[model samples]
Target: MTYSGSNYRGAASVPPAGGSGGARVAAAAGGGPTRRGLIGSAIGLVASVAAAGGGFSVWSTANDANSDLDRAFDLGDLEDRPEDTPALNVLILGSDHREGNAEEDARSDTAMIMHVNEGGTEAYAISIPRDLYVPIPEDPDAAYYPDYTGTNAKFNAAYAWGGVNTTVKTVEALTGVRIDHIVEIDFNGLIEVVDALGGIDIDVEVPEGQDTVTSIHEPYREFSEGVNHLNGEEALDYVRQRKQYADGDFARMRHQQDLIKAIMDSALTAGVLTDRGKLTAFIESTSDAIKVDTDFNVVGTAIELMGLRSDDIVFMTTPNLGTGDQGGESVVIYADDPENPEASNPEAVSLWEALREDTMAEWVEDNPEAAGQDEGE
Candidate 1:
């Protein structure tokens, strides 16, 4: 169970609980986050992106029964799942981990909500900035300093206080959608999967002055201006480097979102699927880095989602109302109001409503700017 190396060496897959039950996928239980791949900035983002791709089958197998999803998490006495709910809202939290210090308490640097429509035809991923000031639930026994007597803290603080449980709770309270599943992706699993699949390509949008390499971390290869083909390390550094750009975290979000698109595109590609060797390695690496809830099913659900492709997925960030000083610290605010923030913003309310109702296709047309993925890709 302890992480011995960067690649999760000697990893093996346990056969899932249902649906052609003999098949196994890598299900190594990760201890905590490390700092070396502080891609915690983007590290968890990488693995979860692949987890979304890799967990497709696993997410399907769960039928509210004794399954892998049940083995994945301890829900205690909480309700099994929400009723009248066929749609799924999956929250993926990415930690900024450092090497040789995996136990160091870390905050969720990246959080994404993937809202899948009932039919699985259209889906959208909304990236919430870590610094967005939002209400965090009280967690007396949190990993970091607990957030008792809830306050409007930075969105990332939810994970620090109570790990994925608090993060999922805070997201549900804010978005008004009950989270069906939670996946935590660590640093190593992402790099392994990307490398195992050869690599992924994404279009890097650089302005006049700055280059892709921002002097933060070394890259595997130098990234050119346009479409850059990157291996695991190179892709991690590329997306994690945000300070070099004027846009700051938002640029990093774009790169991360694009990387998700690229991963999904690559996974659904005909060549990768047909090439059993590549597909097998990719699935194993991805599943190793992921931690799912007890109720998640990989078989039955994934079959219904056969139509999912890269082009079908949409990615966008939370509508940033603007920046302002809150309690003397600068923080990102939501839309509709400058004076009052925190989910009360008109646009934010409307956005969450659309998600709850599963009416994103109509909402996308109403708000052109929030639909970033559709703008180009």
Candidate 2:
């Protein structure tokens, strides 16, 4: 899926998927159009946070089809998240393994930080290229994980070397932002979630000769694009089709962001909140496919997320101005500036810094209204 700036407008108009399924809570206070009203909204937001506190209980009590034992790790005592922290940074990892694959563990095809501002009015998501070189920490002795001597390697390799903790540590070291939570979704689980919400509508800007690329799966084949509706399998291929594009993974990140926005729009429009059975089933199908720290649970997460509207989400790539080979492997280097050295790259470091400072209000003041919602509400 390819979206120009205009496409962002259309995406904002799409309502959120709503159903009685999954965990549901009251609408957050201060969510309506008043600056002081946001305080009430913040209180309601805490309720949602409280609900998320019990997310695991909801997952455990819900359906368990295709569940994996490895996906069930607890968050321990990592709480103490400051209520005033301007942004909540969540590390979302997409593993590239499907059912019946010989490989027990799959490489992460995608890694991103979903930054939600303190006010919850604006969100910024930035993707980390899997190939970018980064330092990996030593592995735990009891876990039998690979130990790295702090040598630079592909970003994704950190996960294979140590697991989620190592990946979080590596990213924290790179960005200087503390990750409040982590979520992993596998290929099968992603397809199932998309299917459950119904297919997402995506606008594909078909470049000339786009039809030459063949499809990966048998039933869902690739086709010429220009506003196409995609099912789960087809959407998976849509975002994962880096080989066919000249821009490689950079293009893939754009498509991935588009797919995510599409899913959020469709899911909200479908009223997933009101449909309890469907929500429960959808959660069950995806539960085993994901791994989150113990502190994160469905109830609290639902509450925290409930405060957000589709317009609240923002997506961009890391700023890259140069490319070169490190250790005989290709890598993309983030320029100190992409738009202008004096001006920060909206894609990478600056956006993160804005989130870290909880200054999205200021950022939004600088950026044109993209979400189309009332500002400061």
The candidate scoring highest on lDDT is: 1
Candidate 2 residue lDDT tens string, 242-361: 666777777677677666656555555535545556555555544544555544433333443554444455555555554667657787754442223334334445555665676755
Q: What is the C-alpha RMSD of each candidate to the true structure, in Å?
A: 8.8, 10.9
List residue ranges in candidate 1 displaced over 4 A. Answer: 1-72, 75-84, 98-104, 141-143, 147-149, 209-212, 219-222, 335-344, 373-377
Best candidate per TM-score, number?
Answer: 1
The alpha-carbon lDDT assigned to residue 63 of candidate 1 equals 23
Model 1 lDDT vs. the true structure?
0.56
Worst 10 residues of 1 by lDDT: 27-36
What is residue 190's positional error in candidate 1, in angstroms?
1.2
Q: Tell me the lDDT of model 1 at 146.
A: 73
TM-score of 2: 0.69
lDDT per model vs. reference: 0.56, 0.51
What TM-score would each prediction reach against the true structure? Answer: 0.76, 0.69
How do the residues 1-377 of candidate 1 rate in per-residue lDDT, one tens digit apiece? 11122111112232343324221222111111111122111222222222334443432322221132223444443442333245666666666654566443655677777666654456677788888888776656555667452777778778777777667767776777877656555566557656866887879867457564443665344566788777877776777766767777777777776776666556656677556566556545555555566554433334334334455556677887666778898788754343254446666778878888878888888887777635565
